[model samples]
Target: MSATTSARSARLGLRATPEQETVLRRAAEVAHKSLTDFVLDAACRAAEQTLLDQRLFMVSGSQYQALLEMMDRPESENPGLTDLFSRRPAWAKE
Candidate 1:
C-alpha cells in the first residue's frame, strides 16, 4: 500500500439503521467509491467546513489596519500593578 493508504491503520465503526445504510450504499455506488471511502471523504469535508466556519477568519485591509492601530496604542497603567513595583525582590532581601 502507498504511504497515504498505509497510514490509515485505524478502524472506525458506524452502525446505521437499515434505511440509512441503504441510502449510504446507494450514494457510494453513485460516487463509484466504497462505502467507507465515501463516508470518510464526506465526513472529513464536513469536519473541515465546521472548523473553518467557527475558528478561521479573514479581515479586509482596513480592518487589519484598525486592529494593528489598536494594538499600537500606548499601554494603560493599572493601579494594582504599579503598587507591586514598590516592593524589593525577595531573593535580593535574602
Candidate 2:
C-alpha cells in the first residue's frame, strides 16, 4: 500500500535520556510535528539509508579498472540463461 493511504497500526516503545528527550522535543516543535512523527520519520530515513548502503559500494582506482575490464570482455554463451530469456514470462502468459 502507498505510504499516505496505509494505516499506522503498529506500536513502538523506546527510552531516551532526559537530555536526548529535550533535544528531540525541541526539534519536533521546530519541525511542527509530533514527537512520535519526528522520531518515526528519522528512523525510517535512517533505515532506508542503511539498507541502501548494503547494496552500494566504493572501489579504489585499481578495483574500478578491473571491473571495467570485466565488462569489456565478450559475452559467453550460457544455454540455461538463453533458454530462460527466450521464454515468455509467467505473468505475460494468458
Instruction: Tell me the spans in candidate 1 whose CA falls farther than 4 Å from its real position.
Output: 1-7, 49-55, 78-94
Prediction 2 global C-alpha lDDT: 0.88
* Clash count in backbone of candidate 1: 0
Can you give the TM-score per candidate against the true fold?
0.56, 0.61
Q: Kindly list the per-residue Cα lDDT of model 2 for residues 21-82, writing each as its tens digit.
A: 99999999999988888888898999989998999998999999999999999999999999
Candidate 2, number of clashes: 0
Candidate 1 local lDDT, 1-94, one digit each (tens): 1125567888888789999999999999999988888888888888889988898778999999999999999999888878888777787855
lDDT of each: 0.85, 0.88
After superposition on all C-alphas, the RMSD of every candidate to the true structure, in Å, is: 6.6, 7.8
Clashing pairs in 1: none
**Candidate 2: regions farther than 4 A off:** 1-6, 59-63, 70-94
> Cα deviation of 69 in candidate 1 (Å)?
1.5
